[model samples]
Target: MSATTSARSARLGLRATPEQETVLRRAAEVAHKSLTDFVLDAACRAAEQTLLDQRLFMVSGSQYQALLEMMDRPESENPGLTDLFSRRPAWAKE
Candidate 1:
């Protein structure tokens, strides 16, 4: 279901100065949306962008080729990793 049509049970509250509220209300009016709708739409966009920043990345073509080449390399071991694996995990320790 679309977000607008979905059931909303959670409540979010925030504080803003009177000036801020006035600016927001004016912008919402200019945009032809209710203050609540305007704020919720903007907040959802910001949240989506923040999450996409974590999960998505961009690279140049040359950089992408370099990454592919690195992944194609034969597996090799490091002493540090070997030592780390030899130790007991923190959760397993007394």
Candidate 2:
């Protein structure tokens, strides 16, 4: 079934192991959402990320140059991102 149809349909069924079900329930409770809402939100985010990772991106020569220029630019002076990077765990360092 298409993603939209499957997502909207009320009668669709999914099976999970007891441990998996427990994890899902705990995640739902932590998010302060109903089980259905939690599962749907999580599933949609995962699906979108998977699709974005798998898709091949194509760009015109000008677009490619623009991207290259952006990448080559020095890091932002913004404190929030710099602070976030500076606080990375020791294990995160190469």
* Each prediction's TM-score versus the true structure: 0.84, 0.49
Q: Write the per-residue lDDT of candidate 2 for residues 8-85, one digit (tens) a residue.
A: 756658999999999999999999987887888888789888898789787899999999999999977899878888
Q: Output candidate 2 Cα RMSD.
A: 14.1
lDDT (10s digit) by residue, model 1, range 19-69: 999999999999998887889888988988999999999999999999999
Please give the lDDT score at residue 75 for candidate 2: 78
Q: What clash count goes with each model?
A: 0, 0
Those runs of model 2 whose alpha carbons end farther than 4 Å from true positions after fitting are: 1-10, 56-94
Candidate with best TM-score: 1
Of candidate 2, the 10-residue stretch with the lowest lDDT total is 1-10
Top candidate by lDDT:
1
TM-score of 2: 0.49
